[model samples]
Target: MPPIHLLDLSFQETAEAIAAFVVETDEGPVLVETGPHSTWPHLEGALHKLGYRPEDVRQVLLTHIHLDHAGAAWAFAKKGAVIHVHPVGAPHLAHPDKLLHSARRIYQDQMDTLWGQMEPIAESQLHTPADGEEIEIGGVVFRALYTPGHATHHIAWQVGADVFTGDVGGVRIPGGVVMPPCPPPDIHIEHWLESIARIKQAGAERLWLTHFGPVDEPVPHLDALAARLLDWANWMRPWFESGTPPEEVTPRFQQYVQEQLRSEGITDPQVLQRYELANPAWMSVWGLMRYWKKKLARG
Candidate 1:
């Protein structure tokens, strides 16, 4: 296996909160994730340490269109890099106005401070690969696996015997348990389970997580994530049916999740904050509630 170096974007100055990976290949170096625009300086600094400038990167493979993962991709594309992403996500990256507007509605005043600026990448720079398609850069072969459920446009890039599981792999730091990041408008429980199965069937020896880093024990880590996804969604089902408002439910869910982390012996508040930064409690509340509502409405 070729070397895959991890770059901690230190999102909001929190280490292990977000990560980007650079892989060496015959063509030079390629990026896996870009963290977000707010951490562009950190990314640039990280690249500098690796003895390469951002402009030297020729290709970037994104797991999804989420701002925290792919927001800074345009910066690289500006320097003549090919941006590879899900077909459903390509249009959003090319024309980010709608995505920005939707995000602003949620983030409000914190938008600029939290995410920084997002600029559009030209359509020609975007390459939307089909599921199971393999794209070779330099000497590395990346096989795209359409692993949705976290987002309708999510992909897990499989390289050799390792797979970059993105957010679908769950958020976990050193000494912390795997917990799902269930952000709203696209949190389908059934589909997420199927995607977990898809990952398991891939038979990768290692799973790379964008929230933090790599898990050498792929099967157990994925199993834990799948179980927690169900646990969190089931916990929200009754709350959604009983007409519990988000404002009322968010804090309670946060406390419940905190207890689970505590039981896992993750006692440090700073470490707990990192988990929150990676996967917020309130977002999971909204996401799981939305999932139940959509399912019940269809039934």
Candidate 2:
């Protein structure tokens, strides 16, 4: 098996906020999750530290096309790397104007600082793999499993017994507690739970989370994540039913998560702030609220 190296992007100057995995094979290096373009320089520096150049990447794989996960993918594509992604995300990557515009609505003035520039990947360089498709780049074989709920375009790549779970595995900052990154527009509790089950069914011995690093205890980690996901969704269900505005619920949710962190022994304000930045309470409120609304409509 080709060795997999975890490269820390140091998002927002915080360690382990986001990560990109490099799989070294005989052909060249294959990168998974480019992170936001804002941290491209850091990624380049990390590659250099590992004795590689940007042009050394021959293939780039994305678990999803969310800006944080794939914003800098075009950079690799520009270096002549073949970009592999779910079909649902292929078009947006090929023509990122819509994606950037949607993100702008969320980031506003912080756009450039948060995500940097998202270049469009030319059609020729884009490869959209099927749900169960296995992609062999160099000597490594990655099985793409469509794991939506974090986002409709999400996919979790499985390599041997290790799965590169994007947001499907939730966000865990080092010693901090794990939390669901339920950002808006694509949060579906049922889908998320089902995806978690799929990951479990894959029988992965380790899970490589894009939010941070590899988790050796896959079962318990996934179980805890599933529970927290349902717990957070249930917690927000009533807020939505009460017709509470997001702004009002955001702070309450923030406090609630902070309290949970405290119970888990994470009390440092700075560490708490890092969790907030990684998986904001406001975003969770919006996403979970949307899920409940859609659930009501479906019923």
Candidate 3:
């Protein structure tokens, strides 16, 4: 462990958003995620404050291709940093057409304001990680754990006991409770639970979450995450089962989540914003409903 220093570059005071890591490696400084584009200046400042230049970054490992995690990767790739990401996400980075179009639809006018610019990464700087492959950067070996519930291309980087669990381990609000961010289309409840089980079995010393910081009380937090995962599904499953539209289910799920946050003692508006950034409750509820609909249609 090189004592990875966390950079709250995203400035996520209003929402539970992304956190970038500056890992000091023998090779140089490596970045785990590069928040969104709007936060680039802050990220750059943070790097300088840490006694490093932006060019000091030699490797950038991304958990997935989501805009929040790998969106700003081009900023570093342009500076000669090699990007390591899951194979499923490699193509998207090379040509971000579909990714950008989809995001534009979701974020609408706020897309560019929030995410900044999403540039395509050159093929030379892109490295698709294989499961179980060990990447030794600056002498620290990180084993890529393919934990794909949050996203089909998600992976958790395991170095020693600290697993950089992107969004697989669930979102932990500031007050200490964990909840599932079930965004639509790919939010498979079964697969997500299996991934959680995998993390629990890994016996990690601490889980480094991208939304915020690390947590060591593994069992309790994992339990809360697991229960919430199921509870979210159970709460919304009935609505979809009754032929309720996704748009209709969204508010119900949001209420369910908001109530859960209140129960956990997170009463502040700022804290609520943070949780939203971690896992947009509406998007997740739609994802679960989409999965449910697809499964039922197939059956």
Candidate 4:
């Protein structure tokens, strides 16, 4: 296993809310998850602490192209880094207007402060690796496992005996429960469960989550994530059917999730806030609602 240095981005001035991993490859340092551009200065400082500069990272492997995970990738690409991503996400990175527009709709005024700026990466710099394809950088090899439940273009990059599970592995901060981040436009529950099975089959020694950090126990962590994913989806079913406004469902869902956290013994206010930052309740409310609407329409 190559040396993996986990860099905390301290998203929203909150510790452990986001992370970017720098792996030592023979050729040079390869970065996984650039995090949002809002945290770019912090990420640079984290890299510098480890004696690396952004230019030293020639390869950027993204688990997915969401703003939080891959938003800052273009900055690395500007320094001549090759961006590795899923096929479906390649175009979006190369042409970010639509992606940016969608995100703007969700976060109007808070966009700049939350995610900073995102520019288009040249198509030449974007490499869309096939599922199970391995790319060797320096001497370390990274195998991309297609895991698309959190987002349609998500991939869990497996290096050595461990996996860098973007959002597919769920968000689990220290002393918090594992919660799947079900953001909209592609929150298919069935596909997500299958992806969980795929992660189990990968036989990783540990699951490296971009949301916070590593999980030593893959099976139990994943099982809990699967259960919670179903639990949250089912919890939102009746509300979706009742045509309840998301505003009404959001607070209830937030309370429900917080109570679960409180039960799990995470009483610290900051810890609870980190959970919300990593996986916002309102986003999940809409995401699950959309999932139910689509699933029922198919019946």
Report lDDT (Cα) of residue 229, candidate 2: 93
Candidate 3 lDDT over 148-230, as tens digits, reads 77788999988888888888887776564787777755777778888888888888889888877788877787788888888
Name the lDDT of candidate 4. 0.93
Report the C-alpha lDDT of model 2 over 1-299, residue by residue, as the tens digit: 67989999988988878899998877888899999999999999999988999999988999999888999999999989999998999999999999999999998999999999988899999999988999887777999999999999899999989899999998888788678899888998889999999999999998898888989898889898999998998899899999999999999998898888989999877777678777888899998998899989999
Reference-based TM-score, model 1: 0.99
Best candidate according to lDDT: 4
- Cα lDDT tens digits, model 4, 191-299, are 9999999999989889899888999999999999999999999999999999999999999999999888888888999888898999999999999999999999999
lDDT of each: 0.92, 0.90, 0.82, 0.93
Ranking by lDDT, best first? Answer: 4, 1, 2, 3
What's the true lDDT of residue 67 in model 1? Answer: 93
Q: Which pairs of residues collide in candidate 4?
A: 27-138
Question: For candidate 4, which ten residues in a row score worst on lDDT?
Answer: 174-183
Model with the higher lDDT, candidate 2 or 4: 4
Worst 10 residues of 3 by lDDT: 9-18
Q: What is the C-alpha RMSD of each candidate to the true structure, in Å?
A: 0.7, 1.0, 1.5, 0.7
User: What TM-score, over all chains together, does every model reach?
Assistant: 0.99, 0.98, 0.95, 0.99
Candidate 4, residue 274: lDDT? 91
Against the true structure, candidate 3 has what lDDT? Answer: 0.82
Candidate 3 at residue 277, lDDT? 71
